[model samples]
Structures are given as C-alpha cells and as structure tokens.
Target chain A: MAKVLMKGNEAIGAAAIQAGCKYFFGYPITPQNELPEYMSKELPKNDGVFVQAESEVAAINMVYGAAGCGVRVMTSSSSPGIALKQEGITYIAGAELPCVIVNIVRGGPGLGGIQPAQSDYFQSTRGGGNGDYKLLVLAPANLQEMVDMVQEAFDMADYYRNPVMVVGDGMIGQMMEPIEFRTPVKRELPSKEGWATTGTKGNRKPHIINSLFLDPQGLEDHNIRLQKKYKTMKENEARYEAYNMENAEIVLAAYGTTSRICKNAIDKLKEEGINIGLIRPQTLWPFPEKAFQEIPETVKAALTVEMSEGQMIDDVRLALNGKIPTEFYGRSGGMIPTPDAIIDKIKEMLGGLK
Target chain B: MLNDKRIRIIVGHYGSGKTEFAVNYAMKLIEQESNVALADLDVVNVYFRSREKAKMMTEKGIKVISSAIGHDANLDLPAISAGIFAPLQDETCQTILDVGGDATGARVLAQFKQIINFMGYDMFLVVNANREETQTKEGVLRHIEEIERQTGFKITGLINNTHLLRETTLEEVLKGQALVKSVSDETNIPIKYISAIEKVAQTIPSDVDGEIMPIKMYMREEWM
Candidate 1:
C-alpha cells in the first residue's frame, strides 16, 4: 500500500488489474494512450487479453464483446475518440453490459484539439453516448483517485449491471503523482452469472443479451427497470470533497485537474486572512447537489472553476439555487488558471463584502 | 511607420505550436529592439500549455500578463493594468496573445477589445493540416470563422503548421502546402509561414521564417 508516483492514466490501468479485469481493448489517443500501452505490456503478463484496436469504434465494440462474456472490460480514449465510441457505448448501455471506460478528455466539439479539456463535462455525466440509460460516472482529481476510482468503477459496473466511467483530463493522464491503491477494495462477486455468458451448465436457459425487445410492454419494462436502477444510483452514489467551510466568505468549486488549482488558491487565500473554502466534486453525474444546501451560513458567494467555458458552472448554479450570490471563473481549451489567478478573483469577490 | 507595433495574435487549434510560435516570434520582435508583451489567456488546458512561457517572457523584458501571477505564484485572473491597452499610443512595444484551441479559446480576446482597436492586431491563424480538425480547407475556413466570431477580430494571415509530431518530412510539407493552397483558394487567406518538424522546417528558405520546436524551455522556479 505504499504510495508511488504515477500519472493518472497509468494508475487506472494498475487499478483495473488489481480489480481482476483481465481484458483491455483500446486505440491510441493522447493523454490516455498510456493506459492501453500499459495494458499491452502488463495485462499479458497476468494472462489477460490486450488488443490495440483498429479504431475507437473498434475498441469500444471489442469492450462490448469482452464485457458481454461477463469478464471485466475497459477502454481509454480522449474526447474526440470518445465521441466516436459513443455509438458503441449506447449499445453497451442498452444491453446492460458491465464495463468501465476512462475518458482522459481533451477539447472537442469535433477534434476540438488535444491537450486536456473539460468541454466534455456534459458528455460524461449527461450520458455522453445517448438514450435514457445512465452510466455510473466517477470524476477523479488526482493520481490517487485515478488508481482508486477505476476499481470502484468496475465494482459499480458489476454491482448494477451497468457501464461506469472514470473521467479525467489530459493533466491527470500525463502528470505523475503519488498514489496508494495497491490493495483494492474487496468486491462481491456478481450474483447473476446464470444469466451471464459465463460457461452455461445444462439446466439453465441460455442467456441472450439484447437491448431490443420486440413487444412494447417488454421494452417499457426494461426501460423502467433501468430507470429504477438510476434512481437508486442517484440516491446512494453522490460523493464530494468539502474544504474550510465554517466561515468561508467565498467558495471555489471545481473538479478533476482544475480542483487541484482551486485547492492551491484556497490555501493561499486562507494564509492571507481570506475565508475561502473548496468543494471538489468526486462524482459528477449524481452530482452532490446537497453539498450546497448544507453550506455554512457564513458563506457569502460561490463560484465554479473548470477547464471549459462555464459548462460545469451551470451545475453549481443549480445546486446553490440562488441562495447566495454565485459567479463563475474559468479558462477553456487546455488553459488552466494558476492558483494565484483564482485567488485574485476570490479577493475581488470578498472585497465587496464591506 | 516605425511606431507601428509588431503586435500579433497567434491563434491555432490545440497542439498547433501556437504557444511556441508566439514565444519565438515575440523573441524575434524583441531582438529587433521592440518592447514585447505576451498575454496568456488559455485556461481550458492544464499541462504543456502556453501560459507557462510567461515567466521566461517576463525575464526577457517582454511584459508578460497571464492572469498575472501574484507573489504566491498562482494566476492573478486578468484585468489589464492602466495604459497597456492603448498600444498604438506607445511607440516601441509589441504584444502577442497565445490563444488555446479554436473559437472557444478566442472568446477570451473579447476582454481585450481596447487593445484590438488601439493597435490593429496582426491575427495569425495557424493551420496545422495534420490536426484532425484542420485537415481540410473547409476545416481551416471553419476554424478561421470560429476565431473571427469569438474574438471579433479577423485573421490577416495563416501559418501552415503541417508537421506530424516527429514524422513530418519535406514531402509531407508539400502535401500540407496543397491543403493550405485550398484554404487560400477558398478563403483567400495567404500563408505567411509553413512550419514543419525540425529538419523540414530547418531546410526551408530563410524568407519563409519557418518555426522550429525548442528542445527545452527553462522551467520557472515556482511554476504556475
């Protein structure tokens, strides 16, 4: 359990191996490319399957095929390549397959340019692939969480018979940091193997994996079952990190790589006698909205810092519900604001209090 | 026209070498005895990004303002200091804004309308034909439109950034020139320079001003 310096992406690969994931299928994409490369070398030593897929399209389907067999499966890609995988992802979700996907997001509407970008904030949480299906999404801010969350992602994927995503950005993928997920959390073995494509015994009916239900009633039943699962996920899976809140006059909220900058800013302002706190979101989809409602009354204003032009800020606005003044600060397209830059904003917002 | 500022807006899609381009071009302008400033606005990225160049640019007397870093070394969140905006009024200094990716990036320039008008900026839209987004002429024009729309400023020229990270050859540059030719044909934006991998860019004629990637940049002590 000793901590080791690892880029977030490599940590994910290590976490997956520890979680008993024996197959990885993916193509080359910046930031997250190290995950697949690590798998190509490491997975085989563990007697696992590692395929350098022909394309992002090919990779995700290979994941779909591998996951359908009820073995742990995963893939990694950046935003543009992730976009290509969406079609396959939707199919995976619809079929109720359990798999993990890591998107080391780079900027994009379409090949929006590589380097870390959080413009895909909406894509990951709001269901990047499509449909009424929900994927369990975990947003990791550092290498430690990158190692930890991939295991959690696999557990959640199996526990709920759903897809899970560990969404980080290029910084997390490339930057090495200390981590300690050497011993993964013990997870319950999935109980539904008779229905899984694990080798069938003579007595049970063969499990046919299909999202298509020919009858309207059956499809409605499937959709309703998925909705109920989503509702449970929302209720039980909201996680976040809150810092320095008792007398915070200004709260800076961010996630993933940007939150580290926010934490740095908060530390500086705290030293300078400014009462500032931070809220780093750990799960973006089942956004821990209740955190805002539970904010200390001494807080006067809050703001959102992200790697995009005010995408995640909208969520902060929803969570706070105008109870306190909320302003937004961000720089987009792989541009990260320094802690000092954010502290200036905090001071300016606090300066008006008198 | 000696007072004509060497102000340039080096704009490009991500990984297009715009940051290096802005740095080198500003150094060149500074070498020619012009006071220079490099304004780093890219916030959408975190590593290997443009704003880190600010510390060195500041060391060179090229006034650097990102969100200017405070004493503690975090960004200062930009509000231009007095008199810096009216660059035309100043006789000797030049400014370069290294934007992030595409339109979303150029949107930050809206904050600098004062400078844009004071010194009519020379907007250079770097066209990296190898980039997935900028591979076609339509893609290049579309990028140009996005930057213009976001910054409310026009790109006066283009830089053909056709280098494949390490695979770029002169033969590849010729093909990229064809891609730039199509952009020129469709949008009438002339290519001011064409950059390539070290060897390819090095072999270009001196008049071309082709750019080479720096092997290293001095890391700032307290990096932001």
Candidate 2:
C-alpha cells in the first residue's frame, strides 16, 4: 500500500480501529478533536461504536463500561479534559479493565490555551488519578510512531489487563506525515469469559466489575500486584531510541516532539565538530533506564529538554542516578524551543560541564 | 488552467478539502515560478491547515506565510502575517490565500477586504457533496451565500472537491460533479474544476463540466 499523509489524531484513531478497538468514547477537545471526529464517522462502518459522551468524565466511564465487558475500547482527550476523566481512569485501572486512553496534551493547570504541550508528563507518568496504579505510557515522537503506538497500546492494554496511554503534544496530534499500515493488525486478546460482567448463564457465577476494596489488607495486596505488573513492564516494555550515541561526549535526553528537535540539534551541532547524541524515550513510564547506561563512559553530561519546565528531567535523573551531570532546559506554557535554541542550550551546558 | 488567476482565494465549509486543494494548487503554481507564495489565512482550524506544509513548501522554493504569531501555535486568536501583503503587491509572483473552512473561518478574510478589493482577487468556493450539510445544490449555495455574506466577497468559481478520502470512487466523483453542475446552473458561476484521486480522475466522463484536477490524497485519515 502507498503511504498516506495523515494528521496525528486521525492516524491514531484509525490505528485504534484497525487494532480491533471497536468502541470509542470521547468528548471533543482541541488538538485531539480530529481523533474522536474520525472515530465518530469510521467506527460505525466497522461494526464499532463511537459515542460522544456529554463530558470527558462521562466519556471515560463509558470506556470503563465497555472495557469491563471485555472488548477493545478507547477514549482520548486533551490535558484539562484528561484531568476530568482521571477519576474514571482510576476506576478503570483499579478494575483491571484493559483500555486505551490517548492524551494529545495541551497546556494546562487550568483551561490553559489549546496548544501543544508536554506539561502533562508528571500527570501522566505519575498517577493523575488517586491510585497506586500505573498506566503503560507510550510517548510517540512522530505521526507514524503515534499510529503504531496506539495500535500496539490496544493489545498491550489487554495483555496486561491494564490501561495504556499514548501521550503526545498538539504537534504530534496536528502535524501531517506519511504513514503506511501495510498489513492489517490482528492480536490475540485474552478471553473475558471468566471476569467480564456479561450476563450469567450456563450455571456460571455472575461477574462483578468494581474498583472498591474496603478491606485495607486486600487493597494492599491489589496494590502489590499492580506494582509487580509495573515492575514487569519496566523490565520488558521499556523502549527508547539511541541516535548518534556511538562516540558521544554529550548526550541529550528528550521524548516526543522535543526529542525531534534534539535530534535536529544533535545533527547540526555534530556538523560543527561537537560530539552530541540523543536518548529518546519512546515509553515515558518505563523510562528506558538501560538506554542511559549506553551513554558511553566518555560522555561528560546529559541535557534533558522538554516543552515542560522540568518534569521528565526527574525521570532522566533517576535513570542516570548521578552517573553523569544531568541538566534541564525547557519552554513551558505552550511555547516550544527552536532547534537552534536547543543547540545553544546544549553548547552552554556542554561548556559548563567542561 | 487556473493560471489566469494569479491571486486566488480558496474557501469552503470545514472538511470540504479546501486546504488540500490550496496546498496542491500552490504546488502546481510553483511549477511555473519560484516567486510563488501560499498564505495560510486559516485561523479557524488549528489542524489540517496549509501552514502545516510550510516547511515542505519552503524547501521546494515556495514561500509560506502563516499567522503572525506562529504556524505551530494552536491558539484560535486570528491574526494575519504582515508579509502576506508583499505577494499581493508583487505582480511578478502568484499568491494563493487558503482561507479558513466555513463562514466562521471565512470571517477572518473580512480583515483583508480593503486590500483584496484594491488588488482584485478571484475567490473559489470548494464544495464536497458528501458532507451532510452540503449534500445538495441548495446546501452548497446556502454555504456559498453565508461565506460571501461573512467575508463581503463574491465567489468567482466553484471547485468540486468531492471525495471520501481514499475510498472515493468514480461514481462519487460523478455524483458530486452533477451536484456541482446544478449549483453552477442555479448561480451561473463557472465550475472551475472537479477533483478526484489519481485513479478516479482517469474515469471522469468526457462531458464533465469542469477541468480535471487529479490530486493525491495528501490530507487523510489512516483508515483510507
């Protein structure tokens, strides 16, 4: 099949459909509206359901209802909208219902402008909702990756029986790039016959789907189980890309849109006799700690760049664990630093390290 | 064939493929000269606008002028680039204005009315009959009237850009062409061109009312 030029949001939505996610529940929000819009039109054609719930809160709970029924279900929203859905998300997480949630993050804290932003890092990686659970967060840097990750997210969600998030800023959601899903995606999902809240029949016991555990001990046990699953995800699903790191003296840590700029900066700086490389984390939750170990013994420092002030830097610091000097630079409140600006910051950081 | 209009303003309802037409048109115009500029005057939609292709267009020697604030900025605050006037004054260059999608989006063009009037420009209204609101001649004219009223500009020609993304078939093209013909008959405005994907373009009936503009689906959803 020939490559199709697709915007990030629509691509993700189509990927969801092709991934066998037959149900989507979401309210419209900027930078991510194309996603739900696409679903509203296409899902029905595939014997799927697309419901525009009254609110983000309502939309997520709808996802919960569908996921608890053991079907591939998903929902998406921007930052503030995602915040509204957190309570329901925690419910989904606690219920151990597999579902895909996409956050084409926009500037936030409260009704921030509808622009590309990475300020939701802490909200996403850390539990945004009140819970001791983790979402397998996949941060895609480009349109193709966004499509691929969303498709994978559905299966991963079912594989772990946990919620998965494909997080990116407005740039990834709105930008157009060539993408090809040459072959159809087909994943063997776990059967929900034992746990799904389907009607009781054939002398089988009724199934209940609820997040509540009034007993402290049982809740603690559930938390430990979730932690174990997270540990396994960190060990097995941590994904990152190493670019030009073979002989680097300075490494830049970034992800999503900022990482693309860092890659550009690395190329330009390398042309000027500078030895710089990029460590791009494709999955934000499983922070790819192993990639940090590949930064080479000759590297002097690592600079973390983001659209947020300094959220992901904490993860980079944790990954490095004082193996090298970790520095941070960012432009927040819907502002993106230019590649040249990042190059200058890298030069400054490298100079300071020396 | 559209070479006669050096300054063409493209307008349509949202999802009518106006930006796709504008981008492709800009690419076409640049084949004759390097002094071409495509101005993205779309403040209504933050996504799927011509500015998203600015970098690619620039690399191909066509200047892309977008919002004064920035191309990547998603804020709905409407503002035009001051540099847009340069192409308007430059008779040597061909400039295309990709106005926003609907009457609400077209309202931004009113700000440039004075200059547009002084310079004289041709405006094309793109119609996709597949869109629910514009499925009929009455529906198409209703939107055209609203856009004209909103921008105080008249539509000089019509572009039948009817498509269902990659699923667009020859039948769909012919159906849209017929609907566009009815619209042209009612308004007496010329059907400037009819668009289709490369394969469907080859099957356009010989007696179709407008010139054939075979376009690749540059703006698409992954399902296509």
Best by TM-score: 2
> Which segments of candidate 2 are over 4 A away from where they belong?
A182-188, B1-7, B11-43, B47-74, B77-97, B101-224
The clash count for each model shown is 17, 0
Write candidate 2's Cα lDDT for B51-86 as tens digits: 878888888899899988777766666778898989
TM-score of 2: 0.74
Q: Output the TM-score of candidate 1.
A: 0.64
**TM-score of candidate 1 restricted to chain B?**
0.79
What's the lDDT for all of these models?
A: 0.75, 0.85
- Model 1 DockQ class: incorrect
Per-residue accuracy of model 1 over A1-354 as CA lDDT, tens digit each: 433435466678888998989999999876676688779989999989999989999999998888888898989899988889998888999998999998988876787765677888888877766678887889988677778888888888988888898888878886655556655566675676755776657877778877778899988888999899999989988899998876988887899878888887887777888878888889998898999889998888988888888888888899999888888888876677788888888778877866
For candidate 2, give the DockQ.
0.16
Candidate 2: give the clashing pairs.
none
List-wise, what DockQ does each model earn? 0.03, 0.16
